[model samples]
Target: MDKSIEKKYIPLAAYFEAATKDKITLTFSEIETIMGQPLPNASYLNVSWWKKTKPPLKHFTAWTTFGYSVTEIKLGYYVTFEKPTTDSTSSTPDQDSNDHPTYIIRSIELDDARDVIGLYQQLFAETDYMLYGQNENNVSVQSFRKLISKWKVENSGTMLIAIINGEIGGAIAIIGSTIPRKKHCISIKMGVLEKFTNYGIGTALMTEAENWARTRNITRLELSVMKSNQKAISLYQKFGFVIEGERKKSVKIGSNYMDEFYMAKVFD
Candidate 1:
């Protein structure tokens, strides 16, 4: 049996400032322009926006549940590489071997958006809720194109894709912060291609995202899943996620209000 190394989950805030300034710098205006929305008042620059803002208080509620602590803002993961065990009789594993290398998770790059979107479409094209019911139509090629463009401009690194054998098999997109103060926290949207399910692809992508967020000092990772999607909920729970709350009749699908369960994991 192969030996395994100890892994750690680090807080995002510890590396956020430096990562933003040095790696992924995203301005508030840039994010708004890409997402096609205005910044909420409660954000870092607009403390008063929430008073008049509309629904989707997931972040606001999360912060309140955690006692308005700044440490509550974060949503990604990372991992470090450890030296292989010294077994004289054991031959070194190939570089491509999954067990051979340790990787630090980081934000999704724009160049990878296209492939990631394709993977999402493959996984969710037939689902009842398309893009979490945010889009009028089920996922389509055109929608993926628009999403990629938007992500490219927003500079949000939350979108991630798992690469195996040079192909993308799973993906996740973390929505931008609605409130100014909570901009650091992101809500995730995830999916794995039908054929890729049960193959560890989803876990790998999620692990990478969590590590990426930790590298930037992001403290929390939040997401909402359909009340009926038991498989996804199970996966989130296994990753140390907990149900913080729920939104009743939050999503509208075919004239029906579908409930959503909000789940979160705090790295700190």
Candidate 2:
């Protein structure tokens, strides 16, 4: 199990992991007791809250990481989790070990504002490829919280973060216009921590963002990368983005001016 699972859901995950039965049911209050906290109001009022096994709901990863999924939900009353019936019965250490590192890619939430801000600061300092330099970011926690809330309410954009080894290792943002004439286009910006690069974090984030765009009828996904960032340029090219043009001296890093490639991917 991923230790990065939310603290509140750890106990619940243990409860499910220890279960001998294939199916388990717990009421809202029962779940609250198991987690040592009250269920969020949305859990009681919204069915989507329980049904959505995706990000922005950290608890979903908790149960699913333990091989359980929400089989049924009674809205305010209770929910049931069931383990899939498969021919393979046992999971050994050898079967679990893989070459790649384990990571969770999910939509960003308000609680992640501070961690994200810190991540951006660290990323900016680690490389000049980033748009801002160290200490150049002035985004406040409250301001970031507002931005998250806005993303939740609007259909124009979203942000996703990759949680690796229990920390924010990277994030990607898709920014699009709400105007009817330009709704088909979106711009991408992302960064991975220096130590977390080459572990497929950026690729995973890009894959998720592109899946999201395709589902939303977004046809053009575009971004600008500093010309000197060959690693990023190659990654973009691998994902079908093409260099359409160049912006001369678009970025200034200290005393040096850097050109950037305007790249985009148009979906069929």
Go through the candidates in order and give the clash count of each. 25, 0
Candidate 2 per-residue lDDT, tens place, 1-268, comes to: 6677777677667666655445567777656544545678888898888777767657787678777888889988889877875645443346434334446666776777887898899998899999999999889999999988888888889888876544677999989888999999999999999888888899999999998899899999999999999999999999999999999999988899999999999998
Candidate 1 achieves a global lDDT of 0.51
Candidate number achieving the greatest lDDT relative to the actual structure:
2
Worst 10 residues of 1 by lDDT: 1-10
C-alpha lDDT values of all predictions: 0.51, 0.81
Alpha-carbon RMSD to native, per candidate: 18.2, 9.8
TM agreement with the true structure for every prediction: 0.51, 0.68
**Model 2 segments more than 4 A misplaced:** 1-99
lDDT of 1 by residue, 32-126 (tens): 22222333444544433322223333333221222222222121221121223345334334322323221222344444444555555555555
